[model samples]
Target: MSRIGKRPVDLPSGVSATVSGQMVEVKGPKGTRSFTATDDVTLAMEDNAITVTPRGKSKKALQQWGMSRTMVANLVQGVTEGFKKELEITGVGYRAQMQGNTLKLALGYSHDVDFQVPSGVTVTCPKQTEIVIEGSDQQLVGQVAANIREWRAPEPYKGKGIKYKGEFIFRKEGKKK
Candidate 1:
């Protein structure tokens, strides 16, 4: 038995969880988020909460049980409190700007990199160096941050590039003369 799967997810007031087709939708005061669970996992709405159960006792089913439950738990928390990720540009010429729902990143590249912000996600830049990604879906917020960081990952030589705030990069030593 999975310890995580055995735990029941309690639904707070004004929050509702439902299974629609293969997807599980979690609605809360903050927002709504959904995810398509694995085929072997079964989702059931009980009282004011939801339950995840495996179809069989096999290893595969057991493996998915905890994962599916954890994903559902994250969705519930996301819809309730939302999620955010911060990014920082660490270079002399690198910067970021928000034009409406689009993010313009100039990371020492010849051309500017433009990324369209998805619906239900908000990107805010207090300063050109600081960026914050917010969304009700934890997964979506994380994916967006990763995609943005991929545009110009931190370079080892100068340790200059786009990276998440508080991200650590080991600096490489230059060759001896």
Candidate 2:
């Protein structure tokens, strides 16, 4: 039995859920999101809660049970509270600023990097060294942050680059004299 799957996801006061076949749709204040589960698992909505159960006693069924449950939970959270990811820029003259729908980044490059902001997600730069990404979809928010960080990943030697908030870079020794 799957521990997480056994626990039903509770619907908060302003949130509602509907189950049709193998698909589950959740609507909340933030937005509406849906998930389609595999045939190995079943989805049901009852008493303002959603539950997932495996169709049979098999390894794949059990695996899908837990994953399906988590996916449903994420849908609920996404519609209700949404998701957010923060990035920090480190290095001299490296900064970030929002210009309309574009995120202008200065990561020590000769030319500024312009990142186009996608729909359904909002990117903000509270400070020159800070970037905050917010959106109803968790996956999109994370992907956007990753794409930005890819431009200038933090290096171990000087640690000069863009990185997630609270992330630590393992320092390496420099060349010996």
Candidate 3:
């Protein structure tokens, strides 16, 4: 009954997958990633593809059925092409720079904020006001970008702060003089 769970995940060229017990591991050009599914669902592999099916007619089994399939698909995409997130600094005196594995941010504060880059993710500042985060894991890439943006989130007035590229800031009117 789950539409998403019915579709099998296809393996592209140069990508490989192995399912052992309840764990599924995918290897590709970007990297190798794995996921362990719960007993509510069953996983099968054939012809460079993977499929998921519910173990019983219960609600939990159906829920896990679709989630497990999507997780497998994400693992395939993550290992093959990876993920990226871009952040833009839009305030005066707000900027960022990468020093080796560390990122230094200036957000109009008295002191600069130094962010240490963690393993499995790469953060780069192409320009003074631009920050780019890339990694094989989608969740890690998004979390790192969010952490950087949280340091100086965009405000309503004048929209001065850091924000995701193309993100809209709901502007509010200033008080009357």
Q: Rank the candidates by lDDT, best first.
A: 2, 3, 1
lDDT of 2 by residue, 1-177 (tens): 899999999999999888999988899999889999999998988888998999999999999999999999999899988899999999999999999999999998899999999998999999999999999898999999999999999999999999999999999999999
TM-score of decoy 2: 0.98
Clashes of each: 0, 0, 0
TM-score of each: 0.89, 0.98, 0.97
Kindly indicate the candidate among 1 and 3 with the higher lDDT: 3
Which one is best on TM-score?
A: 2
Judged by lDDT, which candidate is best? Answer: 2
- Give the CA lDDT, 0 to 100, for residue 173 in model 2: 98
Runs with alpha carbons beyond 4 Å of true place in candidate 3: none
Write the residue-wise lDDT of candidate 3 on 75-114 in tens digits. 9999988889999999778889999999999998899999
lDDT of 2 at 165: 100
Give Cα distance to truth, residue 121, candidate 1, Å.
1.3
